[model samples]
Target: MLQIPSWKRILILAVCLFGIVSAAPNLFYGRVEAHNDAIAAAEKAGFETEAQAAARAAWPDWLPSGLVNLGLDLRGGAHLLAEVQLADVYKARMDALWPELRKALADERATVGAVRRAPSDPGVLRVQIGEPAAMTRALEIAASLATPVVSLTGIGQNDLAISAEGDQIVVTLSEAEKLATDNRTMQQSLEIIRRRVDEVGTREPTIQRQGSDRILIQVPGIGSAEELKALIGTTAQLGFHPVIARGSATGTVPGIGQVIYPSVEEKGLNYTLDAVPVVTGEELTDARPDFDQNGRPAVSFRFNPAGARKFGDYTAANIGQLFAIVLDAEVISAPVIQSHIPGGSGIITGNFTVESSTNLAVLLRAGALPAKMTFLEERTIGPELGQDSIDAGSVAALVGMAAVVFFMIASYGLFGVFATVALGINMALIFGVLSAIGGTLTLPGIAGIVLTIGMAVDANVLVFERIREELRTARGPARAIELGYQKAMSAIVDANITTFITATILFLAGSGPVRGFAVTLTVGIITSVFTAIYVTRLMLVFWFERRRPKTITV
Candidate 1:
């Protein structure tokens, strides 16, 4: 009475076989991982060695090689929570706007009178006019500099909010613009951090934005949080500013639109420089570590065409003046321009060690962080602890699985054995899907698998109990089996669908380990449903056909 089409049966068998093959590589994770890494390294180096060749032979290339990626907690890593200083960007925007505002007001000297920058808080640009009656004209000129915010939520709103306070014009970023700027700054920082981490080649590192102003980073196999912090903490804000004056006193006050920076190679030496840079590192096309003419370590850089022209023009005019090379607000060198510099290439020579020079080159090539960040919390997980977790999780999985298999076999005899086989296939499918999707496996993910092993037979149990009920009313074994499956379908769907919904919510709303758990659970639900309904039934049908009994006991 119950029959499966030959095509459906073949399809189910093919899927099960595929799951087994796909998940087989995970059983030998270490060898497979080494082989993959060796291939990657050889390809990058553009050469092959005997060891690499041997590694390649360890596994056939034609077979599926993807393995589930281990999460930070399971792999041992450094974790950091950093808060981006969004206000610093706001202040920088205001400072950069100062020069343009002054130039604009100066152009309208007849109407705005003598305009000068006034002392104000960070992110606030205050301008005072010599004539109080000229305030209105100054505000108009400042308003002209504002542009419409580009974001949809900020439609019809200006980038800068300008106001007149007494005889001064106060300028600050508008609320809408601030939100957009903060989002951009966070995204930029996240990308730069990812590039910096990737340059070190430490496997899969998790770099993500947290709240409005925070970032979470986790790098597996990293020695410590301090090491990771050292890698990305440098803002690497490279700039060439015209030097105003040189001094040894730290207490010297810089004039408006000027900043004082200490020399990197010289103790007690400082230089005052213009706030605006002639050329920033944002225009850099390439940077590499190389030796200077003096044979000392230095970073060589090339700029884009636009930057090259600006550098060439500025150098040609100020041939004798000193220009300060600033990195992260500190002047590395203030070299006097000996001749016109064209082609946009230059060397930054400081008291740099070879390692420092290499790191500097890497940071320059990765681009600069949009703003500074302060670490709010830091953690480093040791490999020993991670191994312990893996060991415990493995033991728990084996124990839970053994208990489930034993319970199933004891409950329904041959039918339980059928359910147990399906459960095994269910797990294989879960792992196979995880590998295929490149999903991360965390500690909680392992727990989810263990739980799935116990829950996988629930559908089979429902079908078996329904068969017993159908036996009382149905005339034959085939008729009872058919009615059982038909009646059990609704309940199985309802239960699994509700559980799948919970997993979806966890994946969407949760982060880190919670998401990992959700992924494992969701995959488990899908595979369990297939194995219980199709795989277990296929085994039962085969057994029944072989015996050809008039009545069968489930």
Candidate 2:
């Protein structure tokens, strides 16, 4: 009557063994972490060092090596909330559209009369025509400039809204285009931030978009908020522009459609270059820190096929002319084209330290942020505070667990000891599942585990009480035990399923530490149910079979 299917018994034992093995690495956390880091470094370097080899050998590859990643709250790190300046991107888009719009209008100057730029709002591109009567034809030409938005959400909508007011034609981004641009900007910012953080090789950094315009960044093991901010704050816009003029005077100014930028190596030396770049960093396929022929620190870059073809054509036609290499609108180098440079490879040399060269390479490789971001909030959580939290949580868990164990033993004797053992296995399974899924453990997650320890015996308690009641009416001890399990099944399943639903809702709706708590609570519910119903029953059956007890004590 109390029999378990052979296959089911084997499955339960396999799960227990897997959990124990998987959770074992956490006991030697530092060593296992070192082992993982060494492997990653070795793979990146294409060779292994003596230290790396030793680290690898310390943790075998065949074993389950996954470990739970610690969250910012528990690990102590820098946090930042940055808001993207969406209006700045809009202004830039309008500024770039000016040259093209001017050329288009000039092509039909015979019909519309002379067209000139008219001052307007930051993101509004307005042009005035000499003849207001021909505005209808001009409006048609201006409307032609509005292209269909390529985004799914913006399909069938034009990128620009064109309107004519008296003699002035106004152009601004359409509502659909603005929505598309905002989404694209946020996604690009998130990706760039992630790349920058990953370049530094930080462990388990949390970089996510918070709202439409804000990004939330958290980096554990990083020193300060300033440091984290520095890694991501750079726009790192790199471009190649045809040089128009060069000057050393303090009051030098650029002509229309040109920009004057100060030299990076030589202060006060300025180079006037075209506002539009022949090629930008977005076309770069690769960038790395290297040394020039003169042994000067430099960053080498290679461009994609399209960029390479454009660059080759320009260089071929413009030999003996100067072109400016600009970074963040500052002239990094202005070198004359002596020969036709093919293949789209070049070096950026400056008065750079080894560190600066490396950082530049990293920036180029990560690509540029789409827009400027202003940090609205910054916080640094110290390791000492995190350690304090860990200590307090550890103490609370130990005390709670001891109280639960004492209560169980006093109430149910040997059956209570079996429940406690099952609870331990349940805890191991929770950690194993967390490691397997790469879940982050926060302070609230620790609380969830402690709460789970106290609650893990619920199913066992139900079965024990039912068995005691059944002992009076049942024919034999085995039948009583079987009936106990059968009677308790419905209540345990109903209770756990309800709680699991609540935890799922919390996980879906909550953020940060709340989500962390929900994760552990959900995992704990599943593991606790498994251990309470299955593991405890297996142990009890083994004990009863060995002793052949006429009457089992609850």
Candidate 3:
């Protein structure tokens, strides 16, 4: 008999009802979005304003609030393709190594003679020894500083490649170390970019690596590419260096281990500082905008435990000396230490507006980008264009549904009505799953939904065709319907399983929009199978039990 048990029928109806309720929020997307944003802002600030309260009240708190996030193609914002300068990390590595190597050689000055740094390639450190015969001893000293590379593939390999060329000792990163550094640098860049974007509280921004040295950023709801660049482009490299001397821009050249940087506020004035910093922004634990004693906008920062100890000791030892506050390469201020600042907390005071101070705090709190990035391509999509895409996608989906519904009804008369109802439920289930999982919907995803609408009725067609075949025999209506479903089950499962496997492959192998299409297709397939195999069958069972007719049209 064509019958479903009482519990099975209830389960089917409950699932369809749950999907409709969960997807209802999308019908009033704008109001619900505002309500969500308001609640988020209030929670973050720990207090709600009048406007926030009003917005939160726009939607009921008891209803399902999850909404499917729209992608850049549907929401419209900034897109950027940036290339990371991996070579920059090489120079930084060399610079940091120079002080340690120079110290090691100086401890063995009698054997190596006098060691002086010589100019070399950007990523190479070269040292000139006064005695040519001591070259082998110099190489030994440099090699002692090499540590094992801290990567799985670079096991048993040292980080530094040290050799002798004439009277000069050459040191550069080893090949294995270079490979490890490139991967580490790219990973750090991606993490820092994600942090910077997330700090601004944007919804579902795509920050992902594209190739070996490139990143693709798509931030929806931002104003433009330039704004997005301004948010994440600044290196925000902050350091505290001991100032050696201050003079005009044309002053004498700095020593081997020192650098000269122009002051941020004072025109034509420069300060020479130690190359190594007492503490860098990487150790910073907190940073926020504040006002100075003179009511000028500034940034206040605190450091972690290790950095605090180093900073406290440095300030205690050099009480009256100038401490340079460097941002990027320029000295923000080189204030003389009035006392031993033991807490590792300090204020950065310079020429700054409130907005600039706040932005600096945000950058410092997010940490520095490991390497510089150069933007190769940028685009800013308008919201109007996104609305047009949504409108077109809506039209396509509606037309596809209408066509599918008409074909089913014209072919199978009243059974088609049950499949049409199941089709509507199928669409609802797709969006419901998307909302529940916080999935993003793109223009390509819309195409997937439209494609699913046409495919949703496929199982019904199979079953109805099978029933037509059985009706030609001498069997009664109930037995014919039961036989149709039983015979069609194998074909339905096989076809859907094959299509699902293809969707999974596309998802694993593709990127960006292709992945978006795959996500929707995958979700649609699952929902369509459920509605076709179960929901439509349950509806048919109810109709047959009520009518109980001996003769029925196929």
Candidate 4:
């Protein structure tokens, strides 16, 4: 009976069973023959020594995929917190507005201020206007920008500043406009990042906004944090155009409203009257990597119903010409048309390897980031450090457990010994839950578990004290044991609740690994309460029923 009742015993045992089971697949693969083939390949390629190759190839799917055995800090890795550069986003919208502004202010003089590509980088253009009256032309075209606008203040009265803000050429926006534009910009940025991450293939990456501008990302098994950094950092601008027809290309622009991707090396190349794109890449609903019938690598795309109809109509209109597929404004492939494609689904054929296909798939799925984020901090840990830390953490945990066991045995004699045994089970359950949930065990998480070792014993101590109090009044073993659990429950619940609240706060306020600590703490507390109160009580009841002693003693 001193061994917890079958139900509570089994309840605790199941978590242990699960942890062991989850680890088994990986262990089995370690010895499998297919893993041996993989090792042989690695060794032949000179990538690894025989033993190292064997160790690597033997890892099974259930095992962690990359180098993160000890987790983020120990094995140096990146932890970045970045805010979207809204100023750049605004400048992009404004640049787009520039043309409309030019067209609106076209006012015959083309008296546009000295307009040229921005010097900082070619992607943006900056315009310097002369006089407040001259700036009027820009303002006349301002309504065409089709986005929230801000007014300027710093203009040199006689000299109007088109680029200052507030008292400068670029001015402060009205409160209403600022709020509206910021909201839209933030959402757009989040969507782009999400889309880009999806394209890049983050199995279970965490991408969420903090406050107004910052984004938080957590990818569990990412090996090359740098690769992800680069992908999200790019701003891809894709376009397409029809090729000029042979007969219509004789010095005349056959593509009036239609933009043509001529065969020339640059945008000015002639010979492109093929026809127009049914839909731009912006209409893409989904993209993935696949292969053609011959197994040639390619990118598959699917458009929405509206995009499909438009694509079909465009194809029908230009059935015999060439259409250029441009990515980031460069021609990738020019597929000649044979017939119209009424269906929105199709593939982008290109020269690609397996790895490139995977990367491209990830990028397409994640979409694009609104703006690139720079890594503020980066860390990568070698396996040796990770292994050493794991060893140290294990030693610390074993020492703590032994100490807890010794204390329990001394405090309540035989009963204390039984509670200490239950504490072992409690620890097992905490790790079991963590393993099952794919939770990373951080240094702080280890600390939480160590604190939980004490917490797991708290209820037992309360029960033992209650039993002692009842026995002082000469109660029988059965009654003392029953009453102890009944009375101690309230205090146990109260203590655990208070700690749970603190864990919740830490999870919210802290970032990265600190929050991992909080998750472990909360889970440990919950598991502790169950093992302490229910499992320990179950053991006492079974012990008492069998012994039937008239007098109880600790």
Candidate 5:
């Protein structure tokens, strides 16, 4: 074997030690980066002293934060599959059109027959009248019901259908509606998931809007799938409708889900024809949490010009009436209108806690998802479970490392110890690489590392084993070590390469956590080859150059 100088061996050892020692900090705070606020505060205060900076860098996250944490299966968290309802967009389209239908029929006094709501599918709602003699006028009027949509088409000769399920409709989403609903559902679901990830405060969350109606969200270190689901599932549709007339002892709005609002259940008139909406929530273009002029908590809104005009018209027509701001069909608040608001700007003042106000602002800013979502599947993993997993994985890793160390020592003696040293460096490099890559250390990844740890010893073992065989026949120690490496090179290369190929399969073919494991393992294998080949050879070369042993035993 070509001998390495003692000085060079010392240089490599120093480098390896430095890496191992430097990685020591990451071992504790790598996941959380320590007291972030304190670190930032010190930096801001210009506390640039080496001692201060080191304190900031070394301060461990004895208690990890939501940031830079591992998730379940690694840290242990639940996985969830969510489904968004594609029907609600169709419903909104239908509700918006009712006003237009009412006006057209009222303008001509054409509908002496009946005003009814019909649907061909849950997502498709169809409004039908007693076969109007003048279908053209009805169609024109219905076409103008809601903005953000075009006119309705028909399946039959004169009957009208919303061209898309998204269009203002005669419902049962005609063929067009289904396609539109699918697209909207996926888009909105992705947006909702993205918002939820931001809320959880993860560094980089993985969210995929899969298929036509499904969303896949992966938040590392966030195991609260339940909380996330609750936040996302709520449609939070906020609407402002003028309560034309209040029912005496009104129980609940029919077909609308029940929610408590300050109401008088004392029965008199069950319903009132005069109770019609003057304005709606659709006109709202922007909403934010703010303080009212009087210092009360309120939601301020800005409406589109069209909304301003419609709102102005409604207030002028019906002065001194109650306008209800409804959320998800439930009356959130109802206050009497004192005067007209022609600017399209308004504030909703209410008795709200700070948390409630902030939540409402978030919902509004996020644009209340197009429809309600359901949790088809949900899993919740607590922090305790995550910690336990970390502990168990740590123990397994240590045990595996100890085994490899013991094997190298028993088999190769002094030379085995050299291989162990190299193996140690390989493991440290694995961790540093993983940290730098910000890879998720899943359970499978831990397994991969353990497997890699064992295999890392293999290269050293192969070299030492080949040397022992060479020593059996060779005349001198120098010649034996040289032949050993030359003979072992082929075996080590072939073995590691094949193992890397297997890891590649696991990474590409596997799903979820399995892929995570494969990635880490593949990296470990590649790094191990470098350490064993270079580090072990350097030691052997150095030993021969200096000691110049007459006969080699180890």
Candidate 6:
């Protein structure tokens, strides 16, 4: 009477086999990882190198190759806590606003008198007018440039605060706009840092916002914190400005609406350039490392349609004048505009090595960080420490597993063997699910598996004890087994459901290693219930039907 339907039995066996096969790749993690990397590299490059081909051949192409990602603690790497300099964005915004404000005021010079920018706070733009009585007109002109803040909370608020102070008009961002800008700056910094890290092809890097202004970056498999810092800290802000004059760095002073920048190649030379760039890197569509006409390393860049139009007009109108290529506020090159360039494509030639050119191309493609970042904390975890943790975790798991298996066997003679087999299958299924989902394994995750090993046999213990009690009442073996399973079902489901809910809460409320533990616990609960209720029951039903035992002990 106690028998599994044919389809149900087949489904259970199929799932067990799938779990085993899917989890097999983790056993050969090193080889499979190399093979996967090789495949990825070949696809990205559109051709296979000899080493890549050899690595690919090492692993069979037909097998499932998904592996559980190791977390920072499990695979030593770089960790950095960086606070974004949000005020830097405020200054840049003010700087960009000065030109537009100057032009607007210039149109009303008869009413507002001669206008010039005055030194003020970092984020404040101050304008001085010759006619003190026309301060009201200056205020009106500044207010005209203010736009409504484009945020939900700041819906009715304007972005700028304009007030007349004596003969000067003070312009600064409104409080609501400052808040909005801070949010945007943090978001942009996080995205740029993530893009830069991903360009290096590292696995499972944690690039997450920690607090309001800080970002926590944990890049597993990276060489060091310094390496990651170098990759992301460059800013790579590129722009093209019209050069006013090039002279020795000794005593040249920039005029109003202009700035002086030192030449990158020529140490003693400086170039005075317009503060407002004709085109910025934000309009770049593509950048690639290439060789110049003389076979020297260079970076080739193409701009978008709007940028192309602006660049073409500027070059055509200023032929024979010097144009400065600026990166991070330094003049990389100052070349004379020989002819009209229409396509918005150009090469940046400087004292660059091939590696620098490639890095520059990567950075330009990723875009620039919105603001500077200051590293608050930095650490480099060693691989040796990670190996020790892995070894310790492995030993704990094996010991816990051995203890559970021994206890199950000692308490319930031959029935314990069925439970042990189910336990092994449950472990495989847990790993199989983790791999399928690309879950990360941390040190805490390993502890969760050890906890799962102990919990895996709990359902079997309940069923076996129930069966023993049924046998005392003179029920037949088949009838007692069926009743035992039926009676134990409620208790097993209640216990696992409560535990699963707890794990879910932990996952939702936690982060990093806490979430890792929750993931393994959650997966273990599902697989353990499946193995205990279905797989073990199916095994027992088969053995009992074949032998036709008249009497049995749980």
Query: Which predicted model would earn the best TM-score?
Result: 6
lDDT of 2 at 239: 92
In terms of lDDT, model 1 sits at: 0.91
The deviation in Å at residue 179 for candidate 4 is 5.7
**Candidate 6 lDDT, 73-144, residue by residue in tens:** 989999999999988888888889999999999999998899898888888888899899988878888899
lDDT of 2 by residue, 407-438 (tens): 99999999999998898899889999999888
TM-score of 1: 0.89
Q: In model 2, which residue pairs have backbone atoms overlapping below 3 Å? A: none
Candidate number that wins on lDDT, 1 or 3: 3
Off by over 4 Å in 1: 1-7, 44-62, 165-167, 202-204, 247-251, 265-269, 285-309, 333-355, 473-475
Instruction: Give the Å error, residue 62, model 3.
Output: 1.6
Write the candidate numbers in order of decreasing TM-score: 6, 3, 2, 1, 5, 4
In candidate 2, how many Å is residue 153 off? 5.3
Alpha-carbon local distance difference test for all models: 0.91, 0.90, 0.92, 0.62, 0.66, 0.93
Residue lDDT tens for model 5, 1-554: 47666787787777566546544545566424545545655665566656556655556545322232354565544466777777666655555555556556566554424555554554444555654554555556665543332224322322225342222225334445456556766776687668756754554455766667777666656548776666666666766665545555566554321133343223243322222344455456777778878887778888788878887887777678776776665565666777877898887667766667767766766666777677777777676777788789889999999988888788778888888878888887777666556666777778888899989988887888888898788658788787888899999999988988998999888766788788888888877987888777887776777787888787
TM-scores, all models, native as reference: 0.89, 0.93, 0.96, 0.69, 0.70, 0.97
- lDDT per residue as tens, model 1, 386-482: 8888899999999999998898889889889999889989989998999888888899999999888877899999999999888887569988888
The C-alpha RMSD of each candidate to the native structure, in angstroms, is: 3.0, 2.3, 1.8, 8.7, 7.2, 1.5
**Candidates 3 and 6, the one with greater lDDT:** 6
Error of 1 at 504 (Å): 1.3
Which pairs clash inside model 3?
Answer: none
